[model samples]
Target: MSRRPPDGEAPVVTAIVVAFDSAHALPDCLDALRGEGIATIVVDNASTDDSAALSERRGARVIRNGRNEGYGRANNTGVRAADTEFVLIVNPDVIVQKGAVAALVDAAQRYPDAGFFAPQIVEPSGRVFFQPRSLLAKHLTNPGGKLVLPEGEACAPFFSGACFLMRRSFFLDLGGFDEKIFLFYEDDDLCRRIADTGAALIYVPQARVGHGRGRSSGPKPGLVFKSRWHQAWSRAYVSRKYGLPDPAPSMFAVNALKTLAAGLSFRRSLIERYGGSAAGALAFLRGRSALRQEGLS
Candidate 1:
């Protein structure tokens, strides 16, 4: 039988934290969720470490996958397992502040038309990126700061995917995140889909999450190459999907070419990273839909 939240009571929320070799960060993340009055599910993406064990130790239900599934698919696994109407999607490195979940619930109650609600995303260093670098850089920073009209919590032009509350029914109706994307641009796709449906995607500053940035990327050099590749590929894919003009490489590309012209004079690290990006761009131009190589979560 389908479960429904009781009337005149706190609405049940299932907090889904996707983990991949995240044992180092799971304790603090799961600890903050404790006593938040929400059931927790740690979706372990076949982590090599003891992420599943740590989550179980923290009293969160664990759904361990046998293979290494990427972000969107893993979240889809947890979302399907959850019975609550509200699902809180957050990264393993994010710490939900006091009243954050409640504030989102309160806003959901207030804004009945909003199917999605995003809270304030603050870095662990207490800084907020208001002015992000590029179109793709904005995907990493704040999404709706410039969308302020009269200055208040309203339907955002877009919202960060780091931590947010979403209506389960509407989310399922939209077919969840596109699994073709291994890592990047899935959140932007979600926000775009919500906006396309004419449903509200509100940004509630009252709620907040402290994100320990860079913790999500396992700090591995190979992962860095994978990230750059997916970043370039996803940007191109999203641009095409939304009927936008083709996304060209950044100004740094000119420098890359200049360095190549000058007898491979650029930093070895820059060349290595840009090499993956160049390959991804070529794949996008060739009309490839999925990543051919595997990437770590």
Candidate 2:
């Protein structure tokens, strides 16, 4: 039986934090959720640290998995356990400002048609990261600075899943993230799937969340490599799924060019990494390699 939130109670908002060795970020994340009076769910993916215990101590309902499940799978696990009407899937590294959660929930409510809603995303330094927007304009604009779209402009190219909230029913109906995409493109895939069902993803400028950039990736080179590798592989998967213009052949060609350029540029490290990745990409393009899989979470 499904657990139902009491009528007239603040719509139960389940904030799902998927943690994998994220001891440092967990407390801040849990505190933000509890501060907002949002029910918190922490899904620990086999953290070597005392992450699970810490989350429980902080009053978050904890779910422990013996093995590391990649991002998508871990999130799905949390979503499945939630009993809320609205679900806010957040990264452990994000800090919710006062009223951010309420604003997101209100935006979703007001925009009834929107499948997902998120606020302006920013770095800890108060600089705006690219909030969700159409692909063309997003790429055309410079990376930093506030991007205010003109009235009637396309608001969303895709939903920003990193710190967005969605209706629980709509989220589950879409079957959650594509498990095949272990990392990067899973968010894009989810947005596309929502669009396929004719639901829009809205950006609520009123809401705001501060993200610590690369909190998981920056200090760890191996994890960074895995992230980039998964990105390349998931790009192929997205291209295949959404019928985006064929990027494999071009990506392979570009990687080959980069490998040569790196070698000529006297960047030995770049050459080593790009050369191997390019070789794998070429093999993929030629049907000589298997579809890349996500590493254990």
Give all candidates' CA lDDT scores.
Answer: 0.75, 0.72
Residue 219 CA error for candidate 2 (Å)? 3.0
> Candidate 1 — what's its lDDT?
0.75
Candidate 1: C-alpha RMSD to true structure equals 4.8
Which stretches of model 1 miss by more than 4 angstroms?
A: 1-11, 129-151, 248-266, 295-297
For model 2, what is the error of residue 40's alpha carbon versus the real structure, in angstroms, after optimal superposition? 1.2
- Model 2 is weakest, by summed lDDT over 10 consecutive residues, at 132-141
- Cα displacement (angstroms), candidate 2, residue 109, comes to 2.1
> After superposition, which runs of candidate 2 have C-alpha atoms over 4 Å from their true positions?
1-11, 131-154, 256-297
Model 2: lDDT of residue 170: 87
The positional error of residue 265 in candidate 2, measured at the CA in angstroms, is: 7.5
Residue range 143-175, candidate 2, lDDT tens digits? 453466433313475646679898888898999
Q: Supply every candidate's count of residue pairs whose N, Cα or C atoms clash at under 3 angstroms.
A: 0, 2
